[model samples]
Target: MTDTERTPAAATGRKQPFDLGTGPGRVLVWFYGVFTVAAASRSIVQMILDFGKAPLAYVLSAVAALVYGFITYSLVRGGERARRTALVCCAAELAGVLIVGTWTLADPSAFADATVWSDFGRDYLFIPVILPVTGMIWLRRARTA
Candidate 1:
């Protein structure tokens, strides 16, 4: 029998592809894309409005935005190099969240305004805290292919 005919599972939906691009991956990609825009805009507005007030925080905001952008791009590109870049960015994101979260919590006065990493992304319902971990998991899964 042909490959398709040899598999009785074909009678069911088991023959279908995982639909990575259209399903979970699609949601993940969209989330990264939205964060890219949101974080970029936030950094630009903060820097333009009063970067002198907190140069370090503003610069870190920009870095976060860039990382989010890179993650979004890598997810859409879907390849070996892209996977590696995504993995690196995700790890960096995790570090950023942890460091910034601790710093902000320990010294709230240091942060005059909210940042993406502030309060562990409390403003965004902690997605900012959890996204990198999820991204890392997804990146690992993609690597097996």
Candidate 2:
């Protein structure tokens, strides 16, 4: 058995690139992608249909969509800088969810409709609330690994 034959890559059959395509990253990317589309389209449609009805909610949804889009892109980019950017975005996302969730609850009349993070993302199965937390954790792990 030569040294080349005993390498980790050889033992593992092949060496896969360290990217969001690997392991939990794959799932995270998928979820972020879905949310990006969902939030963007929803906000666009809502704004077009009746922006005056819920300007705050609709604009917030659009902002959330942009954030999701950026995070998704960062994750797919898959590098140290991307990981750090994603981590920052994820923390901002969590903060947005908490702030908006509390605001909506505190003053129901302030929001004519629900944003993606409304009710702690109850409308979206709480994924908006949970995603950032998971993303932060994943980004931290990916950075170390």
Candidate 3:
């Protein structure tokens, strides 16, 4: 192909740097995706089976599922804007986890059932708590990459 026809990155002979699909990012995406499915499914079942039992916890679970879904989508999109969006979402996810985790611990009676973030995701091996931190670190590094 002629130089004029070459893509900018190709013309410069520099391969495009990896985004969320490489190395640890790939793992992060997988975790987010899994959480999206898990949280969403759990929330749906809980809402259907026991909506009046723990409305707040169930609603929060649904929200967490949505956040996880968005983060997963952004990571897969793989662009500067996507990375930034994912970073912000990750921060929000972390905050949610911490707040909900503490709330559950402080007043167990408030939640008739556990959310995904209950006790810092004790039901899910604490992955919910750790995932955001890992995602934040990965996003920061990807920004520099």
TM-score for each predicted model, relative to the true structure = 0.82, 0.88, 0.91
lDDT of 3 by residue, 1-145 (tens): 9875566875688756657767888898899999999999999999999999999999999999999999999999998889999999999999999999999999999999999999999999999999999999999999877
What is the lDDT, from 0 to 100, of the residue 50 in candidate 2? Answer: 97
RMSD of each: 4.8, 3.9, 2.2
lDDT of 3 at 67: 100
Model 2, range 1-120, lDDT digits (tens) per residue? 987667877476765345854799889999999999999999999999999999999999999999999999999898778888899999999999999999989998999999998989
* Highest lDDT scorer: 3
Q: In order, how many clashes per candidate? A: 0, 0, 0
Error of 2 at 6 (Å): 12
Ranking by lDDT: 3, 2, 1
RMSD of 2: 3.9
lDDT of 1 by residue, 1-145 (tens): 6877676665854643322344567888999999999889989999999998887778888898999999888888876778888889999999999999999999998987778988888887899989999889887877663
| Preferred candidate (lDDT higher): 1 or 2 | 2
